[model samples]
Target: MRIVRAGHLPPLLRLPDGHTKIPGVPVGPLLGIDATARFPEPELRLAPGSVLALYTDRSIERRDSDIRSDVERLQGSPALLGGGGPDDLADGLLRDVCHASPDRADDIALLLTEYAPPRR
Candidate 1:
C-alpha cells in the first residue's frame, strides 16, 4: 500500500484555500498540516493481512497506567465496535475515542484500514 494519500480533514479547524484535496492526491489533508504537523511519518506497504492502525495522540492519553490496555480492549472487540469496513472502523474508533474523552485537549482522529485481497 503506497501512501495513496493522507492528511487532516478540514472541519472544526481552519484550512488554507479551504480544500482537502490537492491536484495530485486524493481527498484528505496532507499529513504535515497544522495540528497534524507533529504526526510521525506515514508508512505504507503491501502485505498479506496488513492492518493499518492510526490514532490521534488523545487516544492514548490517560491518567491510567497503560492506555494500551484500553486500545487492546477495543481491538479485541471488532464486532462490538463496528463490523462494517475500514472506513466504518475508522469512524467508529474516532467516535469511541471522543466519547471516552469528551474534554480531549487535542482533536481526536483515528483510522484503521486493512489491506485485503479485493473480492473476485
Candidate 2:
C-alpha cells in the first residue's frame, strides 16, 4: 500500500504474528494548502492478516496527559491487545479510548483495514 500523509499520523501496522509498528511516513502540508505541493507516497507491503489502523488525534489525545505517551499507549489498547476482529476492536477502542468519558469534547474517527488472503 502507498500512503501519503496529508498532515496526518502514520498508520499503525499490526502483523498477524503479533508484530506492531507505527511507520515513519513523511508529513506533508494539509490538503489544499498548497496546490503545487507534492506529497511523498511511501509504499508498504502488508502480509496477509496484517491490520492497518487509521485514527484521528482525538482517539489518543487527552487534556490530563501527554499526547506522545498516549500515542505509544495505543499499542496496549484493548483493540490491539488480542486477535480480535475489526468489529470488536472498533467497539473496544471507541469504548475504552475515545469514549472513556462522555464529558470530553473531541470528535473521534477510526478506521481499521485488514489484509487477509483466502485460505488454502
Candidate 3:
C-alpha cells in the first residue's frame, strides 16, 4: 500500500498474528501549508487479515500526554488488542477513547479496514 498524509498521523497496522505497528512513514506538511512542498508515497505490503487503522488526531490526542504515547496506550487497549470484528473494534475504540479522555469538546473520526481480495 502507498500512503501520503496531509499532516495526519501515520496509520496503524495490526498483523494477522496480532502484532500492531506504526509504520515509519515520513511526516509531510499539511495540504496548502507549503505551496511548493512535495509528499512522498511510500509503498508497504499488507498481509491478509491485517487491519489498517486511520484516525483523526482529536480521537487520541490529549493536553496531558504525548500523542505517540497515547497511540501506544490505545495500541495496548482492549479495543485494538482484543479479538473481534470491525464493529466490535470500533465500538471498543470509541468507548476507550472517550472514557480515558478528560474532556470531549471535539469529534472523533476513525476508519478501520482490512484488505480482503476475492479468492482466485
Candidate 4:
C-alpha cells in the first residue's frame, strides 16, 4: 500500500500482532504557495490481517488535549487493537472519540481499510 499526505499527520497501521504509525516523507509545500512542488511516493507491503486507519486532524484535536497522547490513546484503544471488521472498528473509534463531546469545533473524518492480498 502507498500513502501520500501533503501536510497532514501520518495514518496508523495495525497488524495482527501489533501496531505502528506510518512515517511521512518531506513533501513539497502546501498548495497555492508553490505550484511546482513535488512529493515522493512511498510504498508498503501489508500483511493479510493488517488494518489501516486514516483520519483528519480534527479527529484527534481538542481544546485541552495533547495531540500525541490522544493519537497514542486511540491507537491503543481496545476497540481498535482488538480483532474486528473495519466497519466495526471505525464505528467504535468514532463513537468513542468523536461523540465523547458536543463542543467540537472541526469536522471529524475517518477511514478504515483492511488489507487482504489476493491469493496467488
Worst 10 residues of 4 by lDDT: 20-29
Q: In candidate 3, where is summed lDDT lowest over 10 consecutive residues?
A: 77-86
Q: Kindly list the per-residue Cα lDDT of model 4 for residues 69-118, writing each as its tens digit.
A: 77787777777877788988887888778655558877899988889889
Residue 7, candidate 1: Cα error in Å is 20
lDDT per residue for candidate 2 within 33-62, as digits (tens), equals 989999999888889888889988887787
Q: TM-score each candidate.
A: 0.45, 0.87, 0.90, 0.83
Candidate closest to the true structure, highest TM-score? 3
Structure candidate 4, residue pairs in collision: none
Instruction: Return the candidate ranking by TM-score, descending.
Output: 3, 2, 4, 1
Against the reference, the lDDT scores of all candidates come to 0.46, 0.80, 0.85, 0.75
Displacement of the residue 10 alpha carbon in candidate 4, Å: 1.4
lDDT (Cα, 0-100) at 15 in candidate 3: 80
Candidate 3 per-residue C-alpha lDDT over 1-120 given as tens digits, one digit per residue, 9 for 90 to 100: 898888998788888877788887887889898889999899878887888888999999888989889888878877788767678888999999998995979989999988676699
lDDT: which candidate is best?
A: 3
lDDT of 1 by residue, 5-117 (tens): 45532111111222111122243556556564433333344354444555554664555546556555445433323345566656665666666667777665656555577
Q: How many angstroms is residue 77 displaced in model 4 relative to the true structure, after the best TM-score fit?
A: 2.0
Which residue pairs overlap in candidate 3's backbone?
none
Assess the local accuracy of residue 57 in candidate 2 as a C-alpha lDDT between 0 and 100. Answer: 82
Segments of candidate 4 deviating more than 4 angstroms: 18-20, 23-28
User: Which of candidates 1 and 3 is the stronger one according to lDDT?
Assistant: 3
